[model samples]
Target: MWPASMPGSILHTAEVPAFDPRTGQLSLASHDLISAPLSLADVFPPEYTLLFDPSPSRPYGTSTSAADADQPAGQSRRKRRRLARPDETASPLDWIRHREKEATRSSTDKESDEHHAAIEAELGTAVEAVRAGWMGKGEDAWMGESKGRYEWREKEDEDVKEELDLVGLGERFAPALDEPPEPLLLSESRSTVSAAALFHRIVRNDGSSCISLDIEVDASEATPTSKATVILPPSSGFLLSQLATWPASAPSIASLGGEKGGWDVLIVDPPWPNASATRSSSYDTFDPYDLWKLDLPTMLGDSPTLVAFWLTNRVKFRRLLKDKLFPAWRIQQSAEWYWIKIASETGEPVWPLDAKHRRCYEGVLLGYYVPLGTKVDLPTLPQNKVFLSTPIGHSRKPFILDLLRPYLLPRDRPPNVLELFARMTLQGSFRRSATDEDGEGDQQKPGIFLAVGNEAIKFNIVDGSAAAGSVRGWLRRQEDTERVCAAEEAV
Candidate 1:
């Protein structure tokens, strides 16, 4: 009889089969057919592999033996041994010996549980005190009390100045601390010329003016990648490479001037702090002085024209710009440009709000001042054009070139233009560096620092001359010629 421990216990006593090629069959015992023997061991790993490894499979029969059935409660059964080879057999007594330890372990667990029960009964009373202490609260835990007058409070943030107590009441009267120092303005000189004229100068100076001059081809004749680094000249007819060039173009103004340079009109956009917005969300850094700290004071010193400062609608920024930034730069108010940014999506008057007589418009304060020697004509100061006013796009300003054109173009012109806090380039505008000192080609393009087409952008370089050769001289002569011509006509 086959042992029940083996799954699908077989009782085969058949003879071996031989293949018959002619009939395409096999002779097993006596008959032949097409079927071939497919052993169970061929379909699955042998039972011996499962036994030695003690693998509990779902489909296969249990590995237990008769010793397992007779084992005591809680006793684990020993797996029935598998034959190593078909010819090998196992003794029944071997199975009983393997399950012996499991039977002993079952009996020991039963005795241990009985002993644990007696110990629990003896210790039960002590456990109650432990539970009570954990659950109890102190007498003062929730005691109610009236609110005290001595309680601390947050101080009101009022403008009233407090009288501080002095160490020696009579002798040590403290003078109020000096008002906080103002924002430092950029006093370093930057030369400002017409944005268009500056663009031409760059073109002529770069020698790449030929490409722009080549009228035969369309504007997009050259692939953007190919012509991105065309060289040009400074607006001053100075042999310096155009600010729009590749590797050679990415240097500082200090490096550009070698030692000395100055600006006529200092246009600036200070990154003043906005309390309502987070640093990341706001296009500006939280630190208002960051713009001043960038050495602007040294950059805007006593230029011929004014410093146009863009201020947000904030009390703090206005104070810094008026009292601190402009003063430090030696620039005074010449005029103002109001940029009313309307929302493109919802063009319902973005700037002007009748509520506070507030327009959706922001202000660009134009401050003007001349250095010790240079002369400027206030009357002739071109009406400060409304350079840029458009609906707001995250951080976009209106294209201000049209507004700037009048002030920039003179009867007798001047050289080069300088743009501060610019995103893109005007054909002639020499935009301030917005990238790493060594970064090439206006990293943010089409927005600022764009190259100009071939045009004769005339400019007069101021060389400390009071007469015709300088910007002031040309202005004086133009006014004189106009007056003389007008007088002759009147006569």
Candidate 2:
């Protein structure tokens, strides 16, 4: 079983400043320069010296009153007032400082309120759009099933939970396991395959028990495998060999037919560690620095690459994305969009817009990877757009294919897509499948490749062939389904 939180075994100890959920604020030992509001003195310095408390006990500085007794010990308690110049009065200096503080506070408050209001309005509009016959017919049915399963899991008795101990299970049961020499291919026409097949394939072919597969459509001679999904185990040697042929600056795209070029669109949802995730024990989290270790820049194509990063609302996480992660990947930040979660029943935010603990929305940070000296024409991505939807489960993001389809490069042919740290398969069907039908059931040609850790293989694999037709059609059907469900939910 996947660890409830990022496995304790992984290196998750990255020190981020603690935050207070009650106040929706960070608890910093010292003020963060990035988050601090700009002031007139910040832009144009005064000639006179000003002495104020360094501690942020108050907005301007530490209070001079008896409130110092309530503050923690060792903190600076020496109260100092702003010094006046020989030409200026003390009252004038005090007024200037007070005005600057008030201006900063006003700017911060206005930005915060506007952000909250935008979330509310966008969420409400999306809900109304679904209600106005925009949802697909089968969309709500599938959603209902998923919602039911989620509810059941939540209501299930904790004592009755089945625990699978994987620590030593593999070594104990399968001592002679070896890495598979070739990839495992499963077909619907062939006998049904299961996790047992994965094990057998690994042992028979001398492949690693912890191998992850890349799914592709088999265009060879017609058989049970014709147009069927072929799962290829990731080969480090194969990848390195292919990378050797490409220019050092360009991304190496993996082809189904073993051709050149790299993934055109990359979607990454890093498992950023957080306090809520730790408390819930629902999924694992990773240290922010570990994200830099991912060789994402090596996976891009020669063309301009569009990369979308799912980000948390935390200030530290956003800072890491803008400051470190984007720069390390050689991708420039282009746009930041909000994914606002609405109520399935009321169309309002699932949480209040001003909720202190959990905000109603998350962020999608979009960036582009432009190879040096390469000028590629790319579509402009709108900044600060809001995508409203009722989320399915914890950490599960709404499908954004329809939202981002227009902005993809090489509009003629299908774009090659890859998802990193993927929890579920990215089938073109726009619906999460319950079983591994492969890609046979999809109406659209499959172009997405998924890579995840071995522990995550328990979930369904990608069915490249299953994703058929245009994304617009799937989105229309989804809206129709949501519309019907919303009506029922309101009733």
**Cα deviation of 77, candidate 1, in Å:** 79
* Cα lDDT listed for each candidate: 0.30, 0.41
Whole-model lDDT, model 1: 0.30
List residue ranges in candidate 1 displaced over 4 A: 1-264, 275-286, 294-303, 343-348, 355-359, 379-388, 408-415, 429-491
Model 2: per-residue Cα lDDT over 350-450, one tens digit each: 66554543577788999888766787777866555555555544665544544555577764344555555554332221211222135333222333343
Determine which window of 10 residues in candidate 2 has minimal summed lDDT.
31-40
Per-model TM-score on C-alpha atoms = 0.34, 0.50
